[model samples]
Target: MFLKRITIQNFRGIQEMELNLAQPSGNRKQTLIIGENGTGKTNLLRAVALVMGGSDALAELLNTPDDWISFGAPFCQLSATLLTQAGEERSIQLTINRGDTLKGIVLANQDQLAEIDAALAHATQNYFVVGYGSLRRLNRSTGFSRGGETIFRQARATNVATLFNQEALLNPLNTWAMEVDYRTNGKGLDIIRQSLNDFLPAVKFHSIDKEKGHLIFLYGSTQVPLHLLSDGYQNMIGWLGDLLYRISSAFNDYQSPLKAHGLLLIDEIDLHLHPKWQRKVLDYIRHKLPNLQLIATTHSPLLAQQAQEHELYALKRTSRGKIALEAFRGTPDRLLLHQLLLSPIFDLETDESLAVEELKKQYESLKRRKDPPQGKLHYLATQIEQLPQNQRSNMNYGNDQLDLLREIKSELKARRDS
Candidate 1:
């Protein structure tokens, strides 16, 4: 199931927002939601996760519709359009009433008693949506007693469960590997390893230590357990392994598990990943799983630069205490990294320190003048020299801020007008 469109009203900090997740020419692509912290990126994803993943069980489990509902509003509604594999489109709405204190689901576009049952059945599982919050820490629970299908609305009460449930921590890949070790071709464990091994050569996850109960990877010549890997690797691979496991289970007997269609929501996709990896990680996912509709949030400009046309979105908090959604136009990948940061995607006016910014304005002012401003060049040079070494290169000037300022100083000093 591909979540083709969504419109949220009075959900959390967001008052109203609408989005279209379709790409050009009917091709499939991922959507990157970018916003500053506390700008409702998580809220939007959670709203979708709650309604799509089944809110019936989740709403009551969470028991906090008051929090999900917007302030001063008696109710909140999440409207969505799901595109099924057969090309059928379904519209559904999940509403929470504050006065009555109950959750309700009904057909959004139809009026019929007969369609209610089918719609209810279709709401929960027919159109699948699985997600991970910003803190996607996978537990090393190998006991096989961890909560499963029964937990996180049967587990999307409006996404409160998915994001706030204490039991959200997922089981490690080792436990699943141990369960399916060598039986039935390790039961999709190889799907994760084989699919990602070449793509992630830095972490050579060649095999698993079946008897020792640990997923092993060759770090050069040393065999390192998943726990022994750096936090960067652990944070990334841990949730990814769990995600692949979920996809494989959901799409069993399909043409290709990775190619299966569904909505994959990831909050803060750049969490624990280095900037270098952040730049290409989304692209890698898009290339490998083109069919899976990816909805993820991130604050990294490096990650934002990977967004193609019509894929980058932003959540900005308004002055009236509501969040607004903005779709970024044009190809973000064509912009330079700094340009991307300054663009609406990041909403950054300047990638410079206040000191350098003030200096730059003055420099431009003086450079624009045709004639004398005696000893002005010396003063600018002194100010540039006073800046800290670390802040020098980040002045948003060429290679070195010091070098650029010195060039201006030298050029101005040699001027006959001076």
Candidate 2:
């Protein structure tokens, strides 16, 4: 259920990139891949999805074999080592030839392959739910073209989107109360309904039928269709639902003991989320899904800052057309970086002494030049001199002026640190 490591070769823009997952510790199970846009973040996710289920979900995101190879290179390869819940280890390696033919190889003992096959079969069922933008696009198109029937059909066809769609399909609270009765012991259907209601207060699903026609989702209270929630929301719900479904399936099998290891890969986890929400969302995932192994990519410095050192992979492109992934070290204070980046334009803090000395020098030089503009300079000097001791000692000016000073200070600090 968990991915121990992944080695990607000639996959899309990545000539070769290997990443290792840290073991789950305490209540947190998470790994964060940090990189700028177009630096193979999404490609990494595509590689995982492709290996996990061999689905077409990553088709649009991947380059064709011809395109994936370096300017004059050949073929593409992706491989990963995974540990399943049954304490069995497995490996998958996929290679694409120049003709676009894929050669897939799985390495494991018979029992491990059986487990991996089963898990992969289940994974394929819900793979479509992995991308939120795709759902939103489907919803918008369905709204105009098919009256939402297409959306519902597509969602159900890909089991991944069904939970969100199902959540949306439930009646409003008041309506459900009128139609459904609570059981005496609050078990059975009542428990299911209550749990659904509690876990999904903001979610609603609407369907309309024309006489004998099939039901279809028409509208939702949330801005997008249930399928079209923000990527963070979609990823959270989809991942949780997938885990729950797998757990339920495992329980039903009876023969397999409950396995604690699970692997999760997320790309651009900060997509369509604000900084504050990003932290909260990630924290929620880590806390709520403690036993699962998580590997995710992000461009948000905030996310990088929040992640543990062992859980971070910094991806950089080498001149030879290969992606080099290195474990991130040192304390990355994203907020401080943000402040320093903004300081050049706005002064978050000021040195009044330096300001006064500079002003005095300028004023004296202006007076020595016998400039008639001494009137304005004199007025500025008098204003500076009249400032209170505390204010004059160290002043924090407005953003516009403070920014320039901050940049200067940052450059000096960088030099000193180096």
Candidate 3:
């Protein structure tokens, strides 16, 4: 199943917005949302979880119903178009009123409601939808008891609990690693290992030490437990590792559980990830699980650079002070860091200091005068030379960078033609 599109209104900081997540091309399922802090990125993700998970989602993410809807607004409405496994697209909508109780969600369309209700009821088959918040941490490996559980329970357990509820995290990977390795004859651990090692540069998950009560990894020349690694390793390992266990459990019979197709809602996809590793996160996961539709938010420009035009959406506050989801056009993969930040998506007016801007104005103003002051003009020019934009333009990357530059230009030209 896939979330084809979404319409969120009166929800948190968003007044009204719509995003077409999946297109008919099917290959354009991966979507990346970018916005400044407090632009409602997290709220948007929570809205989707509420729609997908319904009241259970509301309970998991929120406590105050009145505050759930945008302050001063009457209520919050969430609408979504889901592409089911049978290739049918169904539109479902629900709302949360200011005074109304947030017990169970009641849909506006009974026919569509019945379809979604049935799918949600089964929770094990037909379609799969999971939500993940950005709080990923592996503090310890003890206290988790061994047992078998369905994917539905596991997904919800990892969704927002990591950020909101610390008690919910009780050695998720350690709890299930031994059982999965035992059942699959080490094949399960192999999938987890390869997946982790492929994305990470130096760290590798070799195996889980049953005696240590935590998963072990090969970091550089030495080995270490999950908790012993740095926060970045633990964050990625805990998050992706838990996701694998959940999805794999759903498709335990398959040779590779990543083959299971579904919609994955993850907030702050770049959380706690290094720049090098973060740059390729989307591409790596998408390459392995092509059919899985990923809807995520981030502030990372490197991650946004990897997204196709159709897959990129920016949330910005309008002139009237309302938040809107704007689609960024053109081939962004070839844009430089500064250029990307100054694009229509980011709308960064200028990264230079006010002093530099004043210098630019003075230079322009002096040049316009009939008898311009050459001394002041020369001083302004020197300061302008120090500006980042000017420095980039005058950069000399040495002979070794020429080939890479040429290749990038050629690729950019080809993308522009398409």
Candidate 4:
């Protein structure tokens, strides 16, 4: 199933916002929302979880403050339109009023909706809706325990250890192997190994510490614990690993890597990621879970730019307190920093650095003067030369800065000669 659209009203920093996440025909299955801090990116993701998860979603919303009912607004409203795998359309809506509990409804064809509901209900049974917030939980593996009770709990995107253990793997693989004529355990290991290598080649899963409680990763010859890794490494590992476990747990279809179709809501998907990682994260997710509908927010332009125009949504809040989705046209990656800085997505008025902004102002000032003063012209040239070559190169707009500086110098010489 995939989400078609989501409408949010009076929620957190957003007064009203509507996002059409469905890809244009023939486009890929990824929707990326980008905005400055506090533009209700996180709120939008949380709203999706609540609407899709139903009763289980309520427990998570309890952490929201009472004042969550936007100031001067009576309540908050969140509605999502979903397209089921069977081509049926349904809409789920939730409302939260001040001094009252949140209410929700699903509107669709009864039979079609029931099937969709059953899938979601089965997801809840397997703890399937993966919510990965900014601060991901990290822990050392406490190894295997025979006779341990399997915790059938709603799975957070950060916690998938329960499903990664021997018990979880052995039980499912052995059962599948017995039913079929194939060795499922070996195949499962191969899938896990290949997935990890694809996502993070430097780190492979080390032998499980049955004697000691620790899950280790192989970095050369040394075994490293999850907590010991850098935050970026840990974050990616935590989310991607959990996602694999979820897919395996929810569906027995091993022929396809990820068989269960579920909603993946990630707040700040680029959090703690390097630029390299940011560029590849979405592609990796898409490759692994081909059918999973992904809704994610990111501040990284690298990540946002990589997505096709139809897959990216820019959330901009107007001065009057209304949030709207800005249209992203043309190929995003083709736009340089100067263009991106001015794009509606970033909404940058000037160069990111103060020195560059000053240089731009000086250039404009010199351009405006009918007969520019020698001192001002010389100063502008000197400032441009003083800036690093790469910095000046990046700051170039329609005209190259070095060429402009030379042109201004030639003009100064001609004026003196006259």
Candidate 5:
């Protein structure tokens, strides 16, 4: 199942918020929420967790409405409606008091308290939500009960029975290690292994390593371990692992037909990775996992430019510390956005007239300089001379400079022709 819509009021830094996911007739997928840091992006996710199930961390981090809004505000509210794979609709509603005192110190009120509790309950019942900091907690508590009984006992028993039938469980501990090894070594996950290999031919995960170590990516014979690798690579690995694990868990849950509906929310998706990788990675995710819904936040213009206008959510902070989110206006095509974001590096411009003027200035400045033995100017002069007269006239160069340029150009031409 996928979330169809989310509505929030007075949650954290957001005074009021409403977001809807695109539900095409055939494909009802997860919605993407795009915003820069502190634009209530993570708060949006927290609202989901709160409405689905009250997470204590969310409660602690997100101040009640009174703290966010002007003094004397009453309550904060959040609601979401999700469409399951079976075509079932599920709705969650939450309300928390913004102002109250714990003993004598100011704190969130009873309604807020109830909402937090209710949200946590809803999350546990429905969506398989995973946050960055909570993976270890989930891994530990997922299949075990407080009383020590395995929660998914039947499923585990069935798998164990199958293993025994195949003589795969003769040494239980060793078999478990071997199974993990196989998965990590890229043996069983055909799609994931192929995808990773296609893009990152040099990277490998070593499951047998006690620390669940992963090999440093080797691009053209360079090998760097996790500790030694750039932060971007490390971030990519973490995201990749989370994606694989979530998909695997969904597939294993036989009773849930809603397994096909997947939503991944990433905060600061552009962190650590270079601009080239930032653009490449998003394109890769969209093409490789068409079935999965992906939403991410990034400050990189490169990342923003790659996103569709409808997929973007720009965030601005107010003086009162509240955040407002809206779609970016006048953004050209996706590719243009990417270019505009990287304009500082590439000198790309959206305004053709302005770009022409800028190019003219650059050409004139380059013409006045003493010709360097080797550099961009020499390269430019060579390229310009090769152009036809009609094309040369269309360039931003002034008539006089173009004339002088042609004299120098002829000297070079004479040298070449000789």
Candidate 6:
């Protein structure tokens, strides 16, 4: 099952917003949402979770009774268009009546009724969404819960763990040990190992140090404990391991291969990740779980640059203050960081650094004075040349600075020739 599109209204920071997220004609399974804070990126993810995870999940996500509605708005609505595993269209919608209970409906084509019903019965397994937030804890004790800190994680962890081992619901450490150990079934470990290697070529999964009760990831024969790794390493392991565990739980056999497909929603997906890793994470995810659909939010332009144009979305605020979606309008691969920073996603008016900004202002201020001393002109040209090329190329005045500098240098040489 995959979410083809989603519509959200009267939900925190979103008055009315609808996004058509169906993957374009391609084998790609990734979609990205880029927005500044408070643009409702997380809220958009929650709307999908509410539909798939049901009312209980929504209740836990909302705080106040009125939190479901936009400030001063009477009601809230969440809806989505879905594609069932059988290639049939379906929909799940929920409406919150202010100060009252929430109402919802799940609809399917008459021919797809039975199939959709069965899909709903195993909704968590069919559309498993791992909504990872930005602030993941590092150096977590080996006994950390599989679900992490969110209410959604806690509940899903319990539900899935119940299906595999009732005892694991109480002792999550058992789940952790099984996840790191290849001896259980050694079925999907190679796939996961390959994924990690693809993202971090030098790092390899060595083995579980059974006596020490820690998972060992190796760097060229050097043992690295999960807890002792850098924040970036631990964060990556934390989410990836949890996802593998959930996928494993779907089959009720740790050694058995994953037989389910689902969605993954990560906020600030680049958190604590180095730029190099940021560029590879999305591709690694696609390679590892080709069937899984991912909708993630990121501040890293490096991640955005790798996405296809159609797969990238920017959450924009209308003049009225409601949120809207805009498809990125540039060639993703050709777009550099400076270009991306100035895109609506980043909303930067000037991609120039402070030093460049100061230099440009000085140059402009000098130019407005009508050809300051030749020494000054030469000095400004030298300073501009010394600035980073990326910053220089993104100057606000476009090629005007270059032309002015060239003209000044020519004039200085002409005086000497005369």
Deviating ranges (above 4 Å) for candidate 2: 23-28, 54-71, 102-115, 118-261, 319-321, 331-418
Off by over 4 Å in 1: 60-62, 103-125, 145-161, 180-190, 199-201, 251-256, 319-321, 358-380, 385-418
TM-scores for all candidates: the values are 0.81, 0.53, 0.79, 0.75, 0.55, 0.80
Worst 10 residues of 6 by lDDT: 103-112
User: What is the lDDT, from 0 to 100, of the residue 53 in candidate 6?
Assistant: 58
Candidate 6 overall lDDT versus native: 0.64
Ranking by TM-score: 1, 6, 3, 4, 5, 2
> All candidates' lDDT scores?
0.67, 0.47, 0.68, 0.61, 0.48, 0.64
The residue-level lDDT of candidate 6 at 266 comes to 75
The residue-level lDDT of candidate 1 at 226 comes to: 76
Candidate 6, number of clashes: 0
TM-score of 4: 0.75
Model 3 scores a C-alpha lDDT of: 0.68
Q: Pick the candidate with the highest lDDT.
A: 3
Reference-based TM-score, model 1: 0.81
lDDT comparison, 1 vs 4, better candidate? 1
Candidate 1 whole-model C-alpha lDDT, 0 to 1? 0.67
Residue runs of model 3 more than 4 Å from their true location after superposition: 55-62, 104-112, 123-126, 139-172, 249-255, 349-418
- Write model 5 residue lDDT over 119-189, tens digit each, in one string: 33564323544333111111212111111013212222211121112221111111222233455564443
For model 3, the run of ten residues with the poorest summed lDDT: 145-154
